[model samples]
Target: MTIRLGLQIPNFSYGTGIAELFPTVIAQAREAEAAGFDSVFVMDHFYQLPMLGSPDQPMLEAYTALGALATATERVQLGTLVTGNTYRNPTLLAKSITTLDVISRGRAVLGIGTGWFELEHDQLGFEFGTFTDRFEKLDEALQIILPMLKGERPTFAGKHYRVREAMANPRFRDHIPLMIGGSGEKKTIPLAVRHFDHLNVIAGFDELAAKIDVVKARCDDLGRDPATLETSMLVTAMVDERATPDLIPSGMRQRMVVGSAESIAEQLQEKVFDAGVDGVIMNLPTSVQGYQPGQITALGAALKPLTAG
Candidate 1:
């Protein structure tokens, strides 16, 4: 089993402008590739964290940033950590991803999810409905987007979305892996079992092993092969030795492969075999320490050697 290493491109209002973030992101992608990392994933947020001060602070859109990443890195795959389906029309979203896949020469993964951040929807004037409603919309989005990607002229009439003809431009284009994020037992996991090529969850080795069991059971009930769904985790980490252990949630810390290289490598191995995850999207809380891109690049380099071991 080959475990792939990936990093999350953090976006928050740390008071640094896009000038600070863009070049750093480019450099990090380049360095991750050089260091033998497999992928780089970014977030999709419209507003910065209010806890970070100010409501309308700096936040980069996911797809546009991914377009830039297409030119920045040669080997490392680039896409969202997970894009919210509520943010865009299904047809338009499919077109953007298809264009991105073309530009990246078949390296884009459509990491999508049912939108969770209520603040984003409220601030952006989009409907902040019940969780059920949002999941319904997400289901519809997946149905429309998948067929559109596969050269079908799709027409979906859901409670949330309506499409007469979903035709992707630069039509019948390349295939990009569809990765769904979240661990909602009812909707998200079932959707993953049905549609996603990969499923991402935020949990430790033991907890993840249990969740994978649940997913496998669901797959069995659906008469689908559990192996068809590749498993992954989105982990939060702090590399600084001085940092307190309680920075992130305890569950996340267990998933986080921090500390020295050897220790981190051991944790990663456990995450792979024990957790049953094939990949990890390391979420470096750089904003917490005002870390430069090179700092992240260094972290990527430090972990890169362990991928081969």
Candidate 2:
């Protein structure tokens, strides 16, 4: 349930050929583990987002990649940063994560959110409903998924989904940690308070404090301790020693930080940790240029003190 330090591998489109793609990913995950990160995450997308690259850019299926990562790295938890709920059936998603937990000896974390990519939906043929529709679907999906993860066969018949005594077998643990990602106060935070072990905050830097306040307030309203629901911010880190503000893209400037190892740590401590978040889950979009052998190792070293217990 705790992810004080997480490394997200959101870019797979390195300059290398497809043959070298996954080996590079394995190297990053393994390096993160060696450098002291508690978790490694991949984006759950079928195509690259517009901001990152062209839609045709290389992208791996999230859970399939995570399952392979389970065998490559030991001691680091693995999962998607957030799986899009519309992409898979609830029962099937449960089975996927449970199998992951067993394979990793209980290092699986179920990170999900209401699917939002219109392009992916339109092209991939998954139903892209209204905002309210997607949230409602997620609510119902959780009703079915939580029970199956707990080793109970739940027969849920909601408007969006139906399951008859659906089960997930050979579980590594009765519970796999659940994390919901998004910034919506109305739906995302409330549902997170109701069910998830963590909330991976997706917000602009200026909005982070208010989001934390809302999370605490929501927990208070539900009579649950805010500390019981851990939180982390998703940040894109440019880890080069020569990193400068101009290097960050205008659209992503607020969500990203550009600096060396020490300076990056300082910014995170001031902007993120000092903003009162529990932890950080960061990705290096620049890494897509190609793998720098020691990039994650250096960043993870600087971040360890901030994430230390």
Q: How many residue pairs clash in all the candidates, one count each?
A: 0, 0
Instruction: List model 2 lDDT by residue over 54-96, tens digit each.
Output: 8998999999999999999889999988999999999999999
Predicted structure with the largest lDDT when compared to the true one: 2
> TM-scores of all models?
0.88, 0.98
Considering summed lDDT, which 10 consecutive residues are worst modelled in model 1? 49-58
**In lDDT terms, how accurate is model 2?**
0.91
| Cα lDDT, model 2, residue 93 | 98
- Tens digit per residue, CA lDDT, model 1, 85-173: 88898898999999888888878888898777898898788787988888888888888999888878888898888998778877425
Instruction: Quote the positional error of residue 39 for candidate 2 in Å.
Output: 0.3
- Give all candidate RMSDs, comma-separated: 2.8, 1.0
Off by over 4 Å in 2: none
Report every candidate's CA lDDT.
0.74, 0.91
